[model samples]
Target: MRSTSLTTGYDIAILGGGVAGCVLAARLSEDPGRTVCLLEAGKDYGPHQQAWPQKVLNARALPRDDVWERHAAVHRIRARILGGSSCINGCWNTWGSASDHAEWSRAGGPMWTAPAMERFRRAAVEQMGLRAVPDGEFSLWSRAALAAARELGYQEVDMASPDGGPGYGTPLLNSVDGLRWNAAFAYLDAEVRSRPNLSIISGASVDRAAVRAGRVRGVDIVVDGQRETVHADTYVVACGTFGSPAVLMRSGIGPASQLRETGIRTEIDLPGVGAQLVDQPGIFVPLTPTADLNTSLAAKQASGDLYVSRMLIRAASALCPDGSWDLHINPTAGPPLFGRLPPGEYEAGISALLMKPASRGRVRLRSADHADALDIDPAFLSDPAGHDVAAIRSGLEIVQELAASAALKSLAGPAADGHPAQDLSDQELRDRVGTYWHPVGTCAMGTPDDPLAVVDGEARVRGVSNLRVVDASILPTAPAANTQLPVLAIAEMLADSLRG
Candidate 1:
């Protein structure tokens, strides 16, 4: 990694020191000659700091308030810290299916073919210290869930496997020694943090990119209650789906009308900046577990041993052909509740989400102030193709069925929802549905001619220079698994491009 520099212009200014930015900063600093500045809006604590917040480091689960919680009518969750969502997220290190990448490759980014993406996936997983739990440690519930899926003709497989074909498997996690191994721990570890060339500036909220003459020159930031400008030779905006667009629009880039309506002068008329907001639609299917299930989990939590909070079954959607995978049947123990047990309660449930949602929404400026929350609308289950609704509802049916299986019945009971899963109406499903929190495509990947294409496959903004969007926002479509793995893979691939 490069050493810290006492220079005015950094070689690269990475906005948002979350999953992508942290990795980007560490990798880019590898050049040694280039100076990289990583700016994060939350706390950036050292690994050995006397008081690393337990909520940020524990392997239990993510805290609910650890991210931006409210957006329009949806209860959104976006990590605001240096490690970003990965710090707060369920550490399920799973990848998109090969077919998923093939579709992306066909869609303008031939470079993202499944075969080509393997290297990046391997690298990210390795960097994050992801590993599978030993067979001996698999929770009885998880093991029983896997057995039930197999009875349904689903094979058991690791989600991180490159083949990535549909199957039920114990999720591989980055956490080690009972601590959630986040991006900061993976890329910006002790050795990387001590580097002089890589400076991490946290607790500073970026107001906007400083764009001039069709190029990004720097960023306006508020730190210590004082505003300052930091210039760089190039800039990378990995500030997440909502934030990247908000930053661009605040800098006078976005839908011209929206910017003008928000009382900001438009420097670019890229209406696509915040247009294609795609998010996976999901909901929890709670079930009453057999007695002693809660007791076992509580004892395990008390033991301080790594516990299985997540076990997933990746299956093709009903809409997907025989050999394609698209739905994620995530049966989690403690995650949705974020590990906060309510006075001896410890029942687990399934969170079924559509891997590929057709519904599109928007994220636009609600005000000109950077501090003001942006208006967000995921518009989930509104897919004209009815794809999202069909996929999630189908997955939930399986969850209900899986819950009813003899194997799972020994571990857990029937659905505890007001109505049985099969009896759920479309409107009831919509009302019950919540987000999987894996949102992307707010800055879509398409050619300039595409009206909603804010950025191309190269990750460049359609009409801006020296600027790029590298987080979940640029995914042409949602991947077939949990998002942290895909985002890290995206960052690893982008690192090669930026370094090259």
Candidate 2:
């Protein structure tokens, strides 16, 4: 649905109505003089609360997140609806630490420093109603895990600074009034949406940017199976890690060999268009609860007032690094979406996440068509140092230690798959791992001299004018935690830069 006037050209055209897209469109339109168009391939719920899907608004673990593309276990569970994956993701509000931002600054510039971005962080907390999960809501299983975490020397279980050292605690989340408060609600409220200069078009799939002489002139989009061109003075590709790269590759702007093979004419020979993909790979240990406990959690979940709150365990300095956590140990009791085990096989799980993975992946065009899913090879656990698997193993050992302790005695079941921890092979490590739902760096922004860079420090596309990439795709590296908050903050900072 188009909301702006029938103008032939706009000041800005934003591709992908995800977290960053919604934010950029809103912030840019605030000028009132700029004509902005936000195009989304997915359905938009609009400004009315009743228009939103109950499943999308409710902060529950829908089965939509578990749908995976089976190529080496690529959990391709991104939200196709408005607000992007934040519409479908677990609502944990994890911001990576100061050191994480410091690393980002080295790639981009001093503008990406934590202090420069802190205002956006505060804005997110205020607008999303982010608050701590109360102690009263802790399940019987979580209470035991809390005691176990303390017993295992994780004294500070409360959520610490995103840049600080490890701690185990119930975290702040984005759920308010039992519904998911996604980016659309935060940035595209009725007041913003009603602006005359702003237009939002849903179900508008972008094919490619129409570039001429290294400058974006317009975008070719597919609306209701018909081709149309939307002219814009400037364009922002915020389609995300997998998408922004695919769009560029299809527009004849990627590696020359890949473009030639696809039967597309070459525009710019960008080797990093779909390279340097990074994500946090993880594994889970499943455990069966006593029949009585299982029955109880099932009943509470049916009530739906509140469900699926959890605490996290981050591994300490000895295991990963001195400044930041290397492992994320999270436990779930009621949520089936957290199930990595086979269907109906277990009632509880302990997920061991390998944060700061050294292994890199690549996303390539399956075909020139925007509809074809990209060929994604995360190459997880391929790190030469083997540090990724080692840190995860350390986290699993902690899970075992917790289970065997008196606090959780008889509450936690036996080890999953019957494989002794030390006996598991490298193949087993690769086979058992999955995603933490955070993927990044497919269009990483860095110093222009860097060969792998796609966009620059200010988010402007390298070698291209009137174009920028403002999304998780431009994340130089994956932040230490979930990508939702960080992605939004990055958009806010870039929006300011664009305005200037």
Candidate 3:
């Protein structure tokens, strides 16, 4: 990490040095004359892989360390490290469907079209060194799952391409030889970090932006237990889906009623700042693996080739739009995500995730304090129409079929007395639901005529000049795939806009 005093002003100040922030910093600082500063609330492990924690660098499992809250609810497990959630995620990279881009274009502009965004997507893929899963990485369970999907009549398609239809395939990975290659390593490499005009500050918490007359003059941040203000010609908020809205509300940029309740004076009454929070919710059906399956998985683990999941089936439910998938059926067999099993025993299951849900949640500030936890309600399957629930049921039906397939049943059988997920009541499904960790649409982008639009098509704040938000929060809807690749591509595209 390059050390620099925060006392000096800069041309651009990017808050929250996560995935998007890193991209913006690297791209915006290309010109020697432009001064860029990236501030992160978490620790920056520097520009070396050896300096990072082993758990964070290991791609085999999700790292609980360096997260915001320890032992918190599963839904709130977001990384507080410099690379953001990429440092702690599954290291999977996949793109959304054409329908997703159409929605984005409607909300943002033509720049969001699939053709327009292709170059940026390709750029992100190259920069991150994303690659297809190697043949050697496929475990016995993965191979069987692929065969099962094939037997089910699903064609194989390129999961990384947006043009593909419903199919079963492996996602591009950001891991190399079991090492997690995070955004920090990709975007903030040694060459980028050596730039004299760029500054990377870690362990600095942003309190609020000092806005006056719809213009941000400076940002008030807390570093080393001291409050200080950093002035910049332009300020960009990339704090992510949850944290970005919290910062805006603290800066008095959200719903008037909610801000007043938190004792914050309103600067811009943007009701959409924290509304429309959407995420992919799913239910995992546990299976009892046969002794033969356990032996094979254990052997793979011993060879350092055990990956919980390597492929997924993109399936469309009855309610899904024509020619698009609404569910992701993932078959996993490996060490349990939570607790450990007896030696040689592994956790095996098939998870059906509702990729395109109509349910909307919200993020609200409990108080004006930056350290205080924000109130977040995912409201999974809470759509009054029950469309989301019905979609999950349809996905569960597919799960049952996949599990009963001869290719899979021979290796892992149904759990004893395990209730069929499709038969579970609404309440029961909600009780057992888990998130896919892909959250978006809090600070949605849209035309100025839309009241809920927090940012405009160019990512500029609706009522604030020289301030913008370029992150997942600006996405008006959740894509039909994991958010990592989409976020990287969006950031890459927005970096060009910021430069222009």
TM-score leader = 3
lDDT winner: 3
lDDT of 1 at 397: 79
Alpha-carbon TM-score of each model against the true structure: 0.93, 0.93, 0.99
The digit string of per-residue lDDT tens for model 1 on 97-130 reads 7767866675547778877777888899789889
Better of 2 and 3 by TM-score: 3
| Clashing residue pair totals per candidate (backbone < 3 A) | 4, 6, 0
lDDT of 2 by residue, 197-307 (tens): 888988888898777799877788988898888888888998888888988888877788998988878888889888898988987776667766566666665565436
lDDT of 3 by residue, 1-500 (tens): 44456768899999998899988999999989999999999999999999999999999999998988999889888879899988999999888899999999998999999999999999999999999999988999999999999999999988899987899999999999999999999999999999999999898999999889989999999989999888899999999999999999999999999999999999999999999899999999999999999999999999998999999999999999899998999999999998899999999999999999999999999999999998999999999999999999999999999999989999998887777778889999999999999999999999868889999878999889999999999999899999999999999999999898
Compute the lDDT for candidate 2.
0.78
lDDT of each: 0.79, 0.78, 0.93
**Runs of candidate 1 exceeding 4 Å displacement:** 1-7, 69-74, 306-308, 334-342, 415-418
Error of 1 at 160 (Å): 1.0
**Model 3 lDDT, residue 476, Cα:** 92
Clashing pairs in 2: 96-162, 97-162, 97-163, 98-163, 157-168, 157-169
RMSD per prediction, one decimal?
Answer: 2.6, 2.7, 0.8
